[model samples]
Target chain A: MAEIQLKDLAHSYAADPEHTTDYAIHQMNHVWEQGGAYALLGPSGCGKSTLLNIISGLVKPSHGSVLFDGVVMNDISPQDRNIAQVFQFPVIYDSMTVYDNLAFPLRNMKVIESEVDEKVRAVADILELNSILQQKANNLSADQKQKISMGRGLVRDDVSAILFDEPLTVIDPNLKWKLRRKLKQIHERYNLTMVYVTHDQLEASTFADKIALMYEGKIVQFGTPRELFENPNHTFVGYFIGSPGMNLLEIEVTAEGAKMGEITVCLNDQQRRLLKSAGNASLKLGIRPEFVQLSSQSNDESMPCTLVHTEDLGTYKIVTVMLGEHSIKVRLDEEQQVPEQNAYLNFPSQWLKFYADDYLIVTDETGDKS
Target chain B: MNKIQNNRAWFLVLPVFILVAFSAIIPLMTVVNYSVQDIFDQNNAYFVGVEWYRDVLQDPRLQDSLLRQFMYSGSVLAIEIPLGIAVALMMPTRGAMASLSLILLAIPLLIPWNVVGTIWQIFARADIGLLGYAINGMGIEYNYATNATDAWLTVVLMDVWHWTSLIALLCYSGLRAIPDAYYQAAKIDRASDWAIFKYIQLPKLKGVLIIGVLLRFMDSFMIYTEPFVLTGGGPGNSTTFLSQTLTKMAIGQFDIGPAAAFSMIYFLIVLLVSWLFFTTISQLDKNKT
Candidate 1:
């Protein structure tokens, strides 16, 4: 296994692309540590596949070198790179049996027949494909075909990594869970570096130890799921990771605190000082719905707002409240008391995130990553 | 909810039945009648049954032409299939060059079969034609009108020139239909060029190849117009295929009983071979997704 690194890498489909819009992947540097399970998560067309392909040597970047274990492999072909990739759809040799499909990569590498047989049988056993080892790949179900596709990589001894490009997309929902657990087992057993590319947050969070959240072709955050939920470095992360996402409100920075039309959101003196020194920049206050507090009556630490709507989500209740023009969503416990009218909302200072220009602004005593 | 079922779909197929009655059934019945009886006049006939069938089957001239027909079709397929695949693989896949190449390849297929024969007839003439003059210039004594081998070669070459494009076009579309992911996957698997073709490309093209093979086989088996135009059954029936021999028997010599029986046998052979080919290929590809 080798650590794959992207050093100032960028890609543009056009030959002589001048504008940033032409670039599918923006200039960036990232690293996938050896033997680590990582996810490159993004929305569609945000260049997740392009990044994955570059790492696997399916694509050569336009601007920068891809380094493997500190060696430049920019000129190496995919075959010589010794990386395997499972595509969005299962790509199996239709005429070959499951045994042959699992043994394909090693056979292509011209491994001896006895060793090839050993690896094939071992991989088939792990993938639970031993039962259908003699069956033609074309007759197997899609998930089985995908497992065979994965097994092609697992059979090889010299593979640097196995990249998964949304490999579970065509699987049934229940089968996806099974396959994911199988992948986790494979990763644990073999200690192979695996990078999974997907647009699904749940899949990324569950399957990856750390996720590189990409936005507009740039990796906006690289952290654990808990870290992303607790401390979002980019406003897009705050908006993208949670179920209902974070509720952001436009505010004006001042010496005392941020002004929201008629009321003020008090910040610590250090944050207030930072805002005062920054001087009249556009600002936003972001808080996750789960973190917001609801008070039935107007109090010293609460701001009175109109209760617009309430939704029961089986386990918890989310209540939308309006403070002037901004609609804010607050999550309350299922058994928690919620006042029909005159409900007040509190944005706990510890949970508040201040954004200057769609990015989190850090100051002294800002984030409690608990 | 109660469902209405009136077998209205059968009524929708009435037009096709009427069409088949006038187009296929009546003419075939007349031929069958002609084959089964000895007719002195329209009013007088005697049952002769399978006598014509036996006579047609035992005719040595027909037997010779049948062997020649198989040889001709076999040569056509053997030469054309591989050559077409090579040309298709070598052709540009996209952009202005690809379009231009496609248009150029379609040129031969667009020419009428008789026109193709006439073109080659003059083109391969010994004294005046470009091909024959060039060959004679190269010190080869080639004259199709007098030499049986030369005439056979000329007809086969002409057919190849006229029809290899059909196979090439079918394979080109098949190759283009393969997704880029397969190539990428093959590269990752470290498959050699030949391995990629043998495993991925050939297996994927089976559907298109089946269609091309069937089309070429049937068309070549029933081939008449091109050789007929060029050779006119030759100096001594040198390039006379089965259809030409049948034509000579039916129209030229007016052997009605024998010709009808021969026609029936010929039709059955085409139908049987085509069915065999279709079944074999589809069975091999039974579990295709």
Candidate 2:
């Protein structure tokens, strides 16, 4: 495995290069280190899959260069790239036995019969496909077929990397965990540079060592899952990565502090300076639902909100509230006593993120808002 | 959910079965009647029992025609199926080109069977036809009309031209139905082009190829119109396949008893062969179990 570098890589479906901004990827410059398990996570049509395909050599970028260990691979075919891919659905040969399906790539490379058998058996063992090795691949269930598809990719040890494009979409929810666990085990054992594309945050976070969160046609943020959750550079990432997502309430900033309607919340000196330097008139406050505390009685600094309803989701309750016209959600503790009609909303002492024009403005801990 | 009474569903299928029976059963019964009774004319007839069947079973002409039919179907299938797959593999997956290729392929299938024969007959003539003229111009003695080997070549070539496209189209449809993920999986496996075809494309194409084989087999084995129009079973009966032989006994000589026996033998051979093909393929599909 060698480091794959994307140098100002951008792509457009159009014939001519419009601009860097006009491209789907928009000048992405990053290195996926050798043996790293990375994920391109985003919603539909966000250019995450495009980036994955480019790395796999299935697609060529409109601008910049893709370098594999410092050698240009911009025009290299997928076969020449030494990469394997598992698709959204099963791609196993229906007529061939599971064993043959697994052995195919090895045979193509002109490996001896005994070696092919050994390798096929090894992959089949990893995939828990040993029981059905003699069976035809088409007769298998969707999950089994997908396993064969995965096995076909995994069987070849010579591949530089393996790519997955929503490989679990066709799999049953109950079986997904098992398959994912199996995949993780195989990745750990093989240490192939793996790039996965998925819209599911949980899948991305669980599978990838580092996640590249894409928005529109650009990578909004690339970081570890913990870093993404704790510190989002863009408001979109903050909103996208969390369940009950991050609440972004528009606020007005003045010389005194940040104001929402008649309420004015004071900011510390550094935060005030940061807001002043931001230059954008529009301000927004974002925080995870887990951080917001709800109570019956208001504190002097607490924001007032009307209790709408609460949804019991086993371990936690998602309490909905109407703050002016906007609905804010708070994840209330399962064991905590329910708050009354009028709930006072207290933003967590830490984890307050301030944004200006969709870009992060200030992320301060310790309630000081610096 | 409302419970559905499925008895009404059978009513929908009634018309189709009735139509098939009318087209199939009446002709079959008439053939049976002819196979048993010797009819000197429309008015004069006598019960021949199994005599006609025995005679037909013993005929060398019947044996030759049956053998030729199998050979023709076998050769055509062997050539067409793989060639079709190769052509399909080379075709574009999407866009105007795919649709254009489909329309172009469907043109030969749309032409009347008799017209295909006529077209080939004219197209392979030495004096006027381009193919014949070109071949002769190449300093090769080529006359499909007079030579047995040339006649066989012309017939086989015509068949390939007429039917290979059909198999290709079927294979193309199957290939199109394959999700892009499979290709990706193959790529990830580091599978070579031939490996992809053998393991991925070929397996995916089995259903279509089965249909192609069955359709081509039935058509080739019962081939009559084209050869009938082109050679008229000439060049010393070298191109007289089963259907043409049956036609001669049934229509030209009007020997109803023997003709009926001959046709039943022809029909049984087709039925038995087709059943064998179907069962064998289906069993192979099941063996993957």
Candidate 3:
């Protein structure tokens, strides 16, 4: 396995592109370590799959270079790249047996018969496909067929990396978890450089060592799952990486503090200086619903708000609050009795995130201990 | 779920069944009747039982035509299947260029069968046609009208040109139906071009290729228009296929009894082959299920 490095990479489907906006993927540079498991996570229409394709040599980026072991692979064909890919749906030869499907690559490269058999059997064993080795590949169930597809990629040990493009999309939900676990186990055992791309936040977070959060053809943040959850660098990342997503309330910043409609909240000296020089005095405060504390008594550091509605979500109660015409969501404990009337709510100062001009302004990182 | 279930929908199919009964079934029944009798003329006929069937089955011409038909169809399929797939492999997979290429490939398929024959006939003439003129100009003797090898080559080439597109189109559709994920898997596997084709493309194409094979086989077996238009059974009987020979006995000879028996045998052979094809395909599908 080799470390994959993407340098100044930008791809544009447009001809004679004039600006960065014309590109499908904006310029970015990052390195995925050798034998590392990484995930490219984004919503549909984002450039996550495009980035995967570029690395695989299926798509040649309009700008920048992709390096495997520091060697530029801009013009290399996919076959020569020595990367194995598993698609969303299974791609197996129906005419060939499962053994043959897995052995085909080896056979094509003119590997010796005895070795090919050994390799095929080993891959089949890993994929739990030994019993179905002699059966035609098309005769397998959807999930089994997908496993055969994975085995076909895994059989060849010489590949630089194995790329999975939403490989579990067609698998049953229960089966998906098992396969993901199996994939993680395989990666750990083999130490293969595996890159998985998915739009599902849970899949991305749970499967990869590092997750690259993407939005609108750009990689907003690439970090560990915990890092993404705790300190999202961009507002988009904050919104994307969470369940109900982070709630951002627009406010006016001043010397004393910020004003959210009629309420004026006090800020510390450092927070005030940061907001003053933050270019636009207009700022937004972001806090995840999980971080928002609901209290019965009013506190000095808390923003007073009224409860609007509560949705019981089995484990917790998702309480909606109206703060000066703006709506915010807060999650409360399921066992706790929800405030029935015009009860006051509070936003903890430690959990507050400042945003300016739609970008997450990170002037203050002193409060975060996690 | 509470929508009306109307029986009036059967009216849409009534006209088709009537047309088919008159145009297909009645003529088939008439042919069946003639196969079991001896007819001297339009009016003078007698019941001769299976005597004619036995006599026609023993004819050497019948054996030759059947052999020729098999060779012809087999050769056509052997050449067309791979050639079509190869052409499809070279085609662009996306954008306006791919669309344009598909439209261009579709042109040959849309051309009338008799017209295709006429085009090949003139195109292979030694004195005038481009192919014949060019080959002769290159100091090689190539006359499709007068030579058996030349006639066979011309017919095979003509059939390939006429039908390879159909196979290619079917293969293209199959190839196009494959999601990008499959290619991704192949890429990461470091699968060679041949591996991708064998393990991915060929298996994916099994359904359509079966259709392609069946259609091409049936068409090639019953092919009377092109070869008849091009060579008229040739200088000898070198190119006289089963369908042509059957037509000759039924129309040229006008010996109703033997012709009827020949036709029945021809129909049976086609029916048997089609049944074999269907069963084989169904078996493959069943194994998959």
Candidate 4:
């Protein structure tokens, strides 16, 4: 196994790209450690698949070098790179049995018959496809065919990495979880560097130790699930990662602090200085629904709001309230009492995040803004 | 609940039944009538039972032409299928080159069979034609008009040149229908070019290949215009195929009764072989799926 390092990597489908907006993957530098399970998470057309293809050598990036264990691999072919990629659709040899389908890569590498047989059987057993080993691949169900495709990748021992391009798209929902667990088990056993590309947040959170969230062709945040949930480095991440996402409201910097319409918001001196120095016309304050507090009694710190609606989801309730012209959501526990039509909401200072021009401001551990 | 049977539906199908009766059944009945009778004139005829069929079956000329027909059809299928697949595989997959290649390959298939025969007839002449004159200049002594083997070769080559493109076009469409993911997966698997062709391309092209085989078989078996024009069944009847022999029997010599008997037998042979072809290929498909 080898660590994959992408240095100043960028890709553009256009023959001659004059601007960064023309790129499908903007310039970025990142390294995936050996034996790490990582997920490249993004929306459709966010260049996650393009990044996966570049790593697997299926695509050649226009701008920089892809290195494996410090060795430049930009000119190497996929066969020489020794990477296995499973595509979104199940691609199998229709005429071959599942056994032979798994054995295909080994046979291509001229591995001995005995070793090929052992590897194929071992992979089939892991995929729970041993019972249908002799059955033709074309006759199997879609999920079973997908298993065979995955098994083909697993059977190769010389592979340095395995890349999955939404490999579970065609699988049944119930089977998707099982297949994902099996993949985790295989990853642990093989200790192979695996990169899974998907647009699904739940899939990424469950399958990857670290997720790289991409937006507009650039990686906005690369951190653990908890880190991303607690502190999103970009406004896009804050909006994309959670159910009912984070609520953001535009505010103006004032002599006292930051103000929304006529009400003043609580902010530390460093945050006030950052806001004053930012000089950006657009500044936003963001907070997750789970952190927003609602109360019936008005206080000096709480802003008055009009309750638009409340949805009692079995486990928790989501309260949508209007503060001035902005609609903010508050997620309350099932045990918490619901507020009436008119209520006062408080944005906890510790949970409040400030964004200047859509990018989160970097703050020190001592609460001093950078 | 009881379901009502619609008897009025029979009236709606009457037009189709009348069309089939006039077009198919009536002509078939006429052939059967002619096969079982000794007809001296349109109105003067005598029932001869199975005598004409027995005589026609025992004829040596019919046997020879049947064997020749089988050999020709078999050769056509053998030469065309592989050649067509190779041509299709080598064709460019996209852009202007692909379009240009498609138009170029389609040129021969658009020519009428009779015109193809006429073109080859003049093109294969030893004295005036480039192909024959070049071969004769090299001292190979090629003359399709006088030699039986040369005539057969020229006829087969002409058929291959005129018809191989049809099979290639069918296979090209089939190959194009395969998704790009298969190739990507194969490449990741490190499959060699031959293994990719054998496992991926060949299996996917099976459906179109079956169509090509059946069409070429049926057409070559019933081939008439090209050979009849080029060879004229000359050089001691060496190039006389089934259709030529049957035409000589019915029209050249006007032996309507025996010719009708032979026609029925030929029709049965073609029908039986086509049924066998369809059933066997479909059975293989079912077994896999």
Candidate 5:
């Protein structure tokens, strides 16, 4: 296995890209640690697939080099890269049986027949496809076909990494869970570096140790799921990660505190200092709906907002409150009480994230940009 | 639990019944009637048993034409299928170039059968045409009008030009239907070019190729127009396919009995061969053993 490094990588579908918007992937550097499970998470058309393809040498980046371990691999083709990739849809050779589909890669590399059979059988065993190994790949269900696709990568012993591009999109919910668990088990057993690309936050969070949140052709944040939830480094992550996501309001930074229009909302001492230091940049105050508390009556620490609506989710409730002209969502536990009237929104200072020009500006306790 | 049965659906089939009777069944039965009998006129007829069938089968002209038809159809399929697939492979897959290539390929298919015949007839003329003049200029004795080999060559080449596009179009559509992911996966797996074709492209193109093969076989077996116009079954009937022979006996000679029997045999051969092609190729994947 190898640590995949994308250094100064930029990709543009256009022959002459005039602006940053034309690039599918903007110039950036990132590294996937050897044997670590990482995810490229983003919404559709955010270049996650492009990044995965670039890593696999399927698509060449317009600028910069891809390094496997430490060697530059710019001119290396996908065939020479020793990378394995599972695609968005299950791709199998219909003329071949399940066994042959799994055995194909090893056979291509001129591995011996007995070794091919051993590896194929082992992978089939892990995917629980042993029973139908002799059957034609065309006859299997979507999930089993997908398993065959995944099995091809697993059968190869010398692959540097296995890339998955939304492999479970066609699978049913129950099978998706099983296949994901199987993938995790395979990772644990082989210690292969894996990068899964998906639009789904849940799939990203559950499958990868560190999720790289991408937006507008850039990696906005790369951290654990909890880190992304607790300390979103970008405004997009703050909006993208949670269920209702972090409620945000355009705020003006001042000497007293952050102001959301005429009323000034109270911020913690550290946050107030951070906002003041990040001067002249457009400011936004963000807090997860889960962190926002609802007070029955207005208080000095609370902002007065009208209770617009409440949605009763099975485990929790999301209440929408109109704070001036902005609608902010406040999530409450099933047992927690919502105000009858005169709702006051309390922004817990610790949970609040301040953004200057759409970037998270929070510093950890040690004065580091964590 | 008991379910109520509705017979109303059976009554709804009346329109289809009327359509099939007029279009297929009644006409087919009339041919069968004509094939088994000797009829001098509307008022005079006699049941001749299998006499006409036996006579038609023994006729050497009919036999020669059948053999020529088989060779022609075989040669057409052998040349066209691979060539069509190659052309399809070379075609652009997307964007403005793909659309332009598609339009250019469709030009041959859009020409009517007779028009194709007329075009090739003048185009292959030894004295005036470019192809014939160039071949002769290359120190080759080529005149489709007088030589049997030359006539056969022109007829086959004309047929290829007229119909290879159909197979190519079908194959192009088939190739386009395959996702880019297959090619990417193949590259990642380190599959050779030949291996990719053998495993991925060929297998995916199987369904469309079956249709292409069947259509090409049937159409080539019944080929009459371009050859008729270009060579006129000339050079001692070297290019006379089965349909030309059937047309000659039925309409040219007006021999009602044997011609009907000959036409009947022609129909059966096409039906049987089409059925064989369909079943054999369709079952190729299913019966792996």
Candidate 6:
């Protein structure tokens, strides 16, 4: 196993990238520690796959370098890098038996036949594919085929890392969960560095110890799932992580206080000073929907909001409330009652986050100003 | 729940039945009738009772031509399949060069069979032809008119030139149909070039190879026009195939009775071999799965 590092790595599919938008993967420095299970998470076309490909040595970056164990690996071939990649679609030798498919990588390295057989069997046993080892790979179910694809990677002991580019995409839903758990187990048993690229937050959170959230070809944030949920560094993260996501409202800073229409929000002295320094820059108040307290009676810190709709989602309810011109979603518990016409919505001070120019302003443990 | 039996479906199929009978069945029945009878004139004919079939089957001339047909078909398939696959593999996968290669390779296939034979006939002439003259200049006696080896080589070469492109095109299409993921996976697996070809490419090409093999086999087995135009079944009948022998018997000698019988046997042979080919390949496919 090796620590894979990207030293200001950037990639572009174009022959000449004239602008930042032209790059598929924007320049960034990141490291995946040895034996760490990391997920590269992003929306589609957000460069997660491109970053994964760069790490696997499939695509040469247009700028910077990829280093494995502190050694430059940009010029190395994928095979020489000793990295295994399971693609989005299951790729197997259609004519080969399941056993042979698992044994392929080992055989390619000229590993001894007996040892190859041993390794293949061990991988098959782990994948629960021993029963169909003699069966041709072409005839298996989609999930089983994907398992065989994963088995090919697992069978090779010399691989420094295994990269998965949404390898569970073609699998059935139930099987996807099972296979993900199996992969987690495999990662623990082998202590192999695995970098999973996916757009799914749930999958990333479950599979990875830390997730690198990419946006517009740049890694916007890299942290644990809890960190991402609790303290998103970018407005996109705030809007992307949760079910209904964090509710963001445009708040204009005035001499009196932060103002949202006629409702004046009470802010501390530091916040008022930061807002004053922020000048005319666009500022937003971000609070998770779960943290939005809804009550029938108005209070000192509460703003009156008209209830537009309430969706009972069995476990919890998503209540969309109109606060002046802004539509704010408040996630309420199953037992929480919705006000008939209007309600008082309160943004808890601790959970309240402030953003200037669409980026979360770094704050200390105690929520403060900029 | 009981299923409904639709007797009205036969009425719906009546038009197709008549069309097939007129197009295929009636003509085949006529051949069958001729094969079973010794026709002396327009009306006067005698019941042969498989007499013609016996004569044709035991005939040494037919046997020799049959063996020659098998050898020619087998040799052509053996040579063309590998050669076509190699040509396809060597071809550019994309861009202007791929299009140019495809157009260039398709030229020989576009030429008519008789025209190909005629072209080769003039092209391989000992005195004036470029090929024969070049061979003679290299101190090799290469007269296709009198030498059996030269005639056979010319015929096979001409066949290869005319048909290898068809196989190549099919194989090219097959190769193109394989996704890029397989290649990437193979690369990551550290598979050797030969191993990739053997394990990945060759197996993927099986579906198209089956079609190529069947087409080349059936076409080569019944080949008459090319050799007839070039060699005229001469050079001591060294290049005479079954179709040429059948054509000679039916049209040259007008031995309709034995020729018709031979035609039936030939049809059966082609059908049986095709069935065997399909079944064997399908069995191999099943065994793998």
Q: Which predicted model would earn the best DockQ?
A: 6
Candidate 3: TM of chain A?
A: 0.95
TM-score of each candidate structure, all chains considered together:
0.95, 0.91, 0.88, 0.94, 0.95, 0.96
* Candidates sorted on lDDT, descending: 6, 4, 5, 1, 3, 2
True-structure lDDT of candidate 6 = 0.91
Better of 1 and 4 by TM-score: 1
* Per-residue lDDT of candidate 3, residues B134-165 (tens digit): 99999999998899999999999999999999
lDDT of 4 by residue, B217-238 (tens): 9999999999999989777888
Q: What is the C-alpha lDDT profile of model 1 across B232-262, one tens digit per residue?
A: 8686987899999999899998888889999
Per-residue C-alpha lDDT of model 6 across residues A57-150, encoded as one tens digit per residue: 8899999999999999999999899889999999999989999999999999999999999999899889999999998889889889989988
How accurate locally is residue A112 in candidate 5, as Cα lDDT from 0 to 100?
96
DockQ of each: 0.58, 0.59, 0.48, 0.76, 0.72, 0.83
Q: Name the DockQ score for candidate 3.
A: 0.48
Ranking by TM-score: 6, 1, 5, 4, 2, 3
Superposition error at A293 for model 1 (Å):
2.1
lDDT of 1 by residue, A121-172 (tens): 9999999999898888987888998998899888888887999999999999
> TM-score for model 1?
0.95
Worst 10 residues of 5 chain A by lDDT: A361-370
Model 5: per-residue Cα lDDT at residue A98: 89
TM-score of chain B of each: 0.94, 0.91, 0.90, 0.96, 0.95, 0.97
lDDT of 5 at A84: 92
Clashes of 6: 0
DockQ of candidate 6 relative to the true structure: 0.83
The candidates, ranked best first by DockQ, are 6, 4, 5, 2, 1, 3
Which one wins by DockQ: 1 or 3?
1
